[model samples]
Target: VLTGFASRYAEPESQTITIVKDNLKAVPARDFNLGIEYGAVYTIKRPDSWEIIYNGTIVNSLHEPVPVKNLTLYFEDFDEFVEIATIDTDENSNFYFNYTKYGNIEQNPLVRIMYKGDGLYNPLDHIEYGGIEMGADQNWWFYDEDGDGWPEWPFTLYDLFAALQIESSPTTSDLSVYLAWMAEFNENSGTSTFDIVSNLEGLLKGNTSWTSGRRDSGLLFDGDGIITPPQSTGFVKSVQYKELVFSTSDVTKSIALDVGTNISNTIPFVTIKENVGDDWDDIMVDVYFTDSPATVYAQRSTSGATITVSIFIVEFDDVKVKVQSGTFSNTGTFAEETISQINTSKAIPMAYYKASGGDDDWDASMVTTDFTDTTTIRMERHGSSGTMSGHYYVFEAQDSEFSVQKAVLSMSSSQGYDTASINSVNMSKSFIVSSYESDRANDDPEDGALDVFLNSATEVRAERHSETSYFNGFPTINVFVITFTGAESVQRGDFTWANSDTFKETDITAVDLGSSMIKSGNMYGIMQSDGTGSSDVKSAFVQHEFVDTDTIRLERYTNNEDGKGHWEVIEWELMSSSPAVYEDFDYLLWNDILDNVFGNTSNQFVVTSWIYPTALTSNQSSNNVKNVFFSKDGMIEIGINESGYLELFLSTDLVQTTARYGIEGLIQTNEFTYIAIRYNESDVDIFIDDFWYRSAVGSIGEPWSGSVNITSGGDLIIGAELIKYSSFTGKLDDIS
Candidate 1:
């Protein structure tokens, strides 16, 4: 028996135990128990044969040796894993063990090292010598029970050392050895693991090495899950610029380009500068793209002159641009003031044109400029004055979030009709396409007089009003398409003309930004008239403004209501810094703000928060009521009632009667709602998303008045109620 001075049990210094006689009985310790009842005993015999020595070092995911201190390791027989001997690792994580055996020695043994973990490092285990069979003739290394393309056991390890996806010069043996050395430390450390096999998948093959950027190294992702040479400077996802020259005597010609599949989110910008023709300034260029063949076409046109067009194609990711194409007539007078105002809103505008309209000054040099504001686009003829008209395209400033597609169509019929089909974007999203006459060799008005219609969400039909045949040939029209996504795109479709004047009324649901984003005088848009009749393509222009949170009213600048106007509205929310991401099922308890707001007798203040509720019905506690938002016991409470309506309950001391006050169906599920409650000396007003718009008018009962005395000393819980039985499920942000 051994007795400890400090701990209940202590290990003896000597490990070898020898017994000369066979008949012996082991007795348990009585009073001097020291808490240890039954102990494991291993029979180790000394042999006269060869000796085996094993030496190894414990390292972390970074491959740096970690000091495990005085950690113990076990060596056991392979079949039954019976413990043969035990050894401890030194401060440098190095361990050495040697054992000699005779004729009864096992062929292989298992060396098991387990780290219980400390404050700084996580627990890990390593098994050496023999391997473990998972099942179905599969070993531990290649086992993937979930079939997630990656080994399920090492998933936690991969997440912990994400930067070390595939080890340096990894082979079958190298990966198996390394994986056995570093177990699942990340999951044991209680760290969140990233799903490596989600939406966009890439297959990693042999010998590929990925470092964690710790040593200033970088990686490249080829769109189809392949990797390229490492870039020493930094990582760039996408950047490509290709310049191609197309020379032709024909007025309009297109050349195709084969861009590989390495590019994701294609935003192709096409620009043209003259290479051969003296009249290069008069040439207009357009481009088209297809997905299957991954082909891009660049088309150019010039009036009768043979031109070599240098087309520059720059591809970028996440760029927003809007195209507005139309026709502007110019007087032959030199420097004639031909002012046409285009409401480009907040977008930076750039305009381009090619001569049309069969005017004598078709060959003259003309340029369009925006002088005072982006709203007005002015064209001036620098050459000798002769009446002329030309088709123009005004592009909004470069935005990082717009998806754009460009194409050109040849107007075939003698009646001037053509259809441009765009497949690059989803028509269900807010989309717009504009078309203008280009590459007609002869500047004939019949070919240039264009009126475009939104035939369907994905198709735009163009028609020239004149019935006359083309003087030279059928002219080609250029179409520019842009689709809005996320918070940037406001709404789409045709405008509904109200009986009053030329005002078009439409309803739009936007992010409740807490402030009016698309207000009057700040709204800019492009309006195209979709005529009601076959031959009714009259001029339609409008100025738009926000009537309220749900309605937009567009008043016509020209009262000629010959056709309904189709519009695409865009708004840019420019913030100096990024906003906080919305959180789910989480809360922040603030006791500091209690004294400032609810201290005085007249508790008159407003509390606002943006919340997206997944469900208003309580499925958690026995109590049906779930305090959905804010609560202060015996003072004030705001929660979802049994009927799923937001109810504001006040203490009887303040309102003189205990009553539930709220609007009908104000707080809805699955919608981001900005809720605000205000209390003055007289009555409490509730606002949902809009400040000026009150929910009191939409209430089922009459408005309730309260006394000036309202006080609460409880802590302010931002997301959930005081007792957290039933909590909010969805996301919450910007609590004030």
Candidate 2:
């Protein structure tokens, strides 16, 4: 009785099935699915350029072998390796192949599973649909029992293409993200068939949770005209006791003479204090000043009672001073007064001033009183009520003096910081106003600034610099400095600088000694006259440029005779005889060179010729640079030296071999003419004067050593070797 095992044809998608192979229960731990999204770690091999051996054998339900278009073969490592297997169907689809050298599963390489019409680059890997992505060469981080950042894996999957064939590449997001996304998408797709029908025309309102207000309150009322106060517990005076109503003028008016008042606005403001937000209804105010030393006071008003009042004079920002003028003529919207006039005479004036500029930025309008011209302008910032920020700039006057065309005030359209940025320059202060109007004078600029510039002077404050009042923008109080030269430049015309400062203004006299790293867009350059190194070149040096000069040069240097500098033929100009071109002996030289060709002393003679590379000699004293050229049958054979001489021995074996000759020199009948009289095998082929003379000579597969070393006065020439036995003479020359 014979029993056969078979697949459950009725349930093709079943995860597990009992198999009866020859009446035996067969199960391999679990069930395997041919087509499914599997998340299993695998041991994959590399797939290289190759042809598919076969798509897996297909079998029908009756156990008959068939063919299927499911087997995939891919080369994941480019030209590295390959995998060939078929999509086996039914009972026995296990793949097996014989291999001793190439195709084997043990050598895990890069492989990827191709799904989308066998296209390896299918987008389904990362698509919102099916199919999974694989790794290529990146080392994946796998977490296990120990801790995070552990690489404890069975194997490191190198390439994705190869890894997919045997095992799917592990990925981040674990199984959670995939499952979550899948579940979410499925739920969104539908709960039941009827739930979808109900919301078939669902409203596509924004899935947001924000509301402008409560519509219910507008629609329904509590039946009371006024909103009843919410239930609350009673509180003490500090947090809950509201301020008693009083007039603002009443508080500051009598409080100027009286000590203090019941209102708390007089508590005084902290330095850097921003006002508490506006809706306090109670009389509450906070001011922050850096230097004001005055105490604040609040007083109840006999002047008024409905409102509470508070007042504080921030004194530090408000300095009692006047402007002075120098080096400038008074003009429209411009005034100036001399230092003597401002200090001694107590007067201020707007003057047209001309200067190179100062350390801080200086606006032409604000410099009403300019006495001395500037060598270089940096500017003085007025952080407080002094001046506006970024509105002032030093000018490189094309003429003797730069004139203020207009006093432009930065308004709402203006950008950057509000108020003024005070620079740390030491100089006298002056005040002025812009002839033009800007909506955001005391406010911040649209563009933005590092910090808010407040006018430190007593005259201007936040509301005082209103767009309507100033017309343009706010004026600036500034400090200026006199330019000075350090000891950096005495005779060299180089700029005065200490080593610590990277930036310097210098005038190059003879040569440029600047650093190699030049700024990206600066016009920094050097000039040179004609020289032996490189010809005239007047251009800025860019990065990664190779500079070759006629005089100064940088080249590869080596101490040994061989393996010195890396040399390759750029273009071999074989025109050695050109008068304009001369060999400079810069070519490589061989060392300790010696070639024994055609030397005989006893019955048989042995000869050998080999190229002697000179440049790579370890022992300098024992090295000789050999330079020779060989020729064979109209072909100029290079680097083969031979001593002019030939010797033939009458061998016992009846072997027939002879030398050939022509008009140029010796000749041969075959390709390589290494003329060797042998009782054994092949050696050097003697090609004399561009013509093959004889076949190989000497011992078989060994160096030449017959009876030739007994006696002979052979001339060992550096260019060419000579054979003393036969008295043969050959010509050779050194390559210059």
For every candidate, C-alpha RMSD to the true structure in Å: 29.8, 41.6
Give per-residue CA lDDT, model 2, range 1-736, as digits (tens): 3347644445356577765422111111112332212221222222431221111232334544432244343333333545443332344532222211235332223333222322222221111101111211112112233433111232212111122343322233242221111000112221111111112121111111111111100000011112233332211011101112234333332222123222221112111101111111111121111213322332211222232222222111112221111222222233322233112112111211122211112122123122222221122222212222211112111221111111112324232223433333111122221211222222221111111111332221121212232233343322121111111111111111121222223222221111111111101111111111111011111111112211111111111111100000001011112122212111111221221212122233223221222221111110111122211111111232122223232211222222212222233211222222222232223323222334434333222323123222222222221111111112211111
- Model 1 misplacement above 4 A: 1-349, 352-400, 433-435, 438-458, 463-476, 484-487, 495-501, 510-538, 557-561, 571-736
Model 2 root mean square deviation, Cα atoms:
41.6
Estimate every model's Cα lDDT from 0 to 1: 0.40, 0.21
Residue 587, model 2: lDDT of 15
Which candidate should be chosen as best, given lDDT against the real structure? Answer: 1
Residue 463 alpha-carbon offset, candidate 1, angstroms: 4.2
lDDT of 1 by residue, 258-335 (tens): 445322323333323232222332244344444565554444334443333322222322233344444455564222
Task: Give the range of the ten consecutive residues with the poorest summed lDDT in model 2.
Answer: 563-572
lDDT of 2 at 548: 22
Q: In angstroms, give how far residue 228 of model 1 lies from its true place.
A: 26
